[model samples]
Target: MPERSLILRPLPPFRLDLTVWALRRRPENRIDRWDGRTYCRTLVIAGHPVWIAVTEERAPGAPRLRVTMRAPVLPAQAEERVRQTLERLLGLRVDLRPFYRQLGGDPRLGPLIVRFKGLKPPRFPDLFETLVNAIACQQITLTQGIHLLNRLAQAFGRRVKDHPEAPPAFPKPEDLAGRDPEALRALGFSRQKAQAILNLAEEVVSGAVDLEAWEDLEDAEAIARLRALRGIGRWSAEYALLRGMGRLHIFPGDDVGARNHLQRWLGRRRPLDYAGVQRALAPWRPYAGLVYFHLLLKKLEEQGFLQKTTC
Candidate 1:
């Protein structure tokens, strides 16, 4: 199918760059590509491969996304997936008004919310990708972890020939499940990490683990379920809760990078341990994850690593 552009009317205060950055994490991310003005990715929609490039413009007092989708599927079918993907990745329906009204007055987090105004917390395409990402990032620098993910994508992910830069979708469970751990180890994963990935994949494939069922679970319950899995610890579980399921209040308390940001934001002299982080974030209730996203943007801005938008 030829490329087609459709419009998506999002709730007020939506910034594509902020949402894309939150989803993609780093400028080097290959799965979600942002070229400043637009965000591009190749998604598997209804089992059909599609390429979508998304941009936004203001319309009649509301923000709207201009989505261009190209694939072998019909435009109408592709539009539905495009809309769904944007809603998931950009958090279009997530109402931050209450959070803003509550935390917007805080001395520490208030300025952060202002700095990254219109920011929305982003989630992985699926629970499987979220778990895979957490496994890859365990005890490693994020850059290295993402490199491993890129290699893994090139190895097993599928793509269309429509666009040269269409990032291959993250590999499916069928692609990784039952594969030899050494195959993943060859992509620079630790042996244990490789085995863990394979195990999780197999479990998902075998119906032993239903990650999507966590949607009906509370944050604590979801965290406990994720932690019960081998190779997933407190940080990994909490991280998955936030990034995988969009549990916006569940900040990965053990995240070193987030801890650093929290410490600096609070002007603390020493680093915050997991308990300290919990204490500091207690008043925020379920919005500490929002603070994490803002701090991530602050770091990227300070380092001049945030992607540039042409529009």
Candidate 2:
């Protein structure tokens, strides 16, 4: 296996650590790994499992990332695919300047923005991964969800060619479509969730559902179509929109943790429901989802999972 390297120039003020934290969410997440300096993940690209390691170059106003990839045999488009996937995963192209200008001077949010300057809203590698994540996390704590996903990946995901001990890539639809629902149940998924995951995988593998096609649809339309799926609901649909399709306008109102985050951040005496969340986020409009990520980082920092970086 030959190793290859490339450089990615992200929009300035980019911090790979913060964006990776937002992507990994819980410290327990095994799929996306960050060991203080570098971020690493294995992806099954063009039928080969490639291990990617990315590190920040730390330029003052122009940040660059160094990406090193190792695989048994690199496909012709491997670098391009890996580059595109990393761009989406770390939100390298998302210019938050408009978002900054929108509410930079606000008393409460200003500090949060300043505190996490280079943080970007990250997305799952693809729509299927996003939906699978949403399904696994339904009604469960994020840590538990990540644990289940880790188990699922270990059970079905493809391992790197030379590193059998490394954590496997997240399972693809083809990897799980023909799998037994009972096997997922053995991994601590409920029977309903197990069936839903299998069904979704089958649909994706069979070409019965074109999850990528949702890219062209508006947020509401996409949500409605996603809700039509077996296990997807309002929250899952909106989550996919924000995290999968890169629609930053969506803040999953049904996300309990986010609602609690908002309630606490807003200093609200009463707990906020879906409607209350919508109302509270109305002013932020398109950037509300960005707010959600900021609050999530705030929660992570408070929990000691994220360290304060000097600005």
Candidate 3:
């Protein structure tokens, strides 16, 4: 396959960290790895695997990004899509709006703006895997959930050529629908989780559920359809909607992290209920999804959820 290289001009300051986070969440997605001077993750695009690399290069006495993407499937238009995706992940559009005027500005939040611009939401496939894994991982630690997801992917996902490092493709609905529910249990799935997967698989295989169609629908419409599934409730539906469909406004109301962040950011001693969160976030309309991620990132920083780095 012919290799392609495209320059992402005037790259946003936080692009590197944002891309790294998306790549790291699922190691199987990586087809190759390089570190130092330039960092790159080789991944599959449009059924063909490709390598995406980024580095800071000095040009005209200023730092600029040098990005290289090699994939037969990297369409000419993909650069724009990738940029939009990165922006969505970093909460760039959501954090800057004047919507949160009610919450008095804190000088502390200033430093966060730069860093916040780099926080990319996890990838869509990873998000789906998380939802499935979370269902399998109720009351379990983060480590356990990851292990289960790894096992599921290993057992059911298809392998891609020339990408030994790439994760197995998630099982198609038809592939899983025919398998015995206990088969998944043997792979460490709980009975409930196994059943849910099968239910989802059946819908997919029977054409009763269309993942593609769901992706194109409005957020509210998508959530309603997801809720109709047996194991999917409001939380699961919102989780899937945001990650699966890229709906920027839906936040998982049941998440403890989300609740805690809202309380802290708003300077409220008590947690905000669903209505309160909605009301507080109303000004950020059309960009609520980005706001939701910013809150999570802020909480993570405050609680030392990850290592501190200059944004």
Candidate 4:
């Protein structure tokens, strides 16, 4: 296999680790690897596993990211897959200038936006991966959810290397489609969650459900379609909308953690409910989800989960 490198230029002041941490959610996540200077992950690209290492050197002008892709294909094919994957996973193409200008000089959100200046909202590679993630984390602590996902990945997904110790890529629908429900349950998934996951995978594999097609629909219609799946509620649907479809307008009003963060940030005497969150975020309009990411980074920094990314 030949290793090829591609350079990406993000807007400016970009931090890959910040976005990686938000997506990985826990230090136990094996698929998303970030050790100070570079971030690496194994993704199944065109049915073959590929390992990509991304690092941005401290340079003047715009930030530059070097993507080294290890794969069996020629340089052209490997670079294309790596570029597309990086575009989606690291949000390389998203322009945050509008978001920055919109909240400029605002008291509460202004400081937050400035604090996490280099942060870019990340997404799962595809809608199925996003849905499965949302399903696994529903009504549970993120740490526990990540642990379950780690076990599931190790059991079902293919390893980046032939070695037993290699990290596995996130599983595909076909990978989980044939999995036994009891196996998932044994991995700490509840009976209902296991059934939901199995059913969702089967539906996707059988062509009965088209989660990716939702991207072509309006936000309201797409969210409705997402919620139509079994075990997917408002929170899960909104989460899928933002993290899966990259719809930045949605803030997931029912998210207790986000609500708590928003309330505390605003110094509200009472907790925010669904309507309250909606009202509070109305001013941000289509950029409220960006605020969610900012708050998440703030929480992570305050709790000491943010590691210095300089080696």
Candidate 3 lDDT: 0.57
Q: lDDT value for candidate 2?
A: 0.90
TM-score of 3: 0.68
Error of 4 at 289 (Å): 0.2
Q: Clash pairs of candidate 4? A: none
Q: What digit string (tens of lDDT, one per residue) describes model 2 on residues 72-184? A: 88788888999999999999999999989988888888999999999988999999999999999999998999999999998998988877545689999999998888999
**Candidate 1 lDDT, 1-311, residue by residue in tens:** 57778898878788888888878777768888888888888787766668888888867778888898887664457777778877887898888899889999888788878888888888888889999999999899888998999889888887866666678878888778989888998999999899889999899999999988886798778878888898999999988888878887777889998899889878999889999999998988878788788888888888687756422
TM-score for all models, in order of appearance = 0.94, 0.97, 0.68, 0.94
Q: Candidate 4, which segments miss by more than 4 Å at Cα?
A: 72-76, 163-166, 308-311
What local lDDT does model 3 show for residue 68? 63
Ten contiguous residues minimizing lDDT sum, candidate 4: 158-167
- Residues 115-155, candidate 3, lDDT per residue (tens digit)? 66545444444334435744755556444655776677678
3 or 4, which is superior by TM-score?
4
Expressed as tens digits, the lDDT of each residue in 39-114 for candidate 4 is 8887887787777788987787788899887755444466787788888998988888888888867788888888
lDDT of 1: 0.84
The C-alpha stretches of model 2 lying farther than 4 A from their native spots are 308-311
Stretches of candidate 1 exceeding 4 Å from the true structure? 74-76, 307-311
The residue pairs in collision within model 3 are 28-167, 89-121, 248-289
Worst 10 residues of 1 by lDDT: 302-311
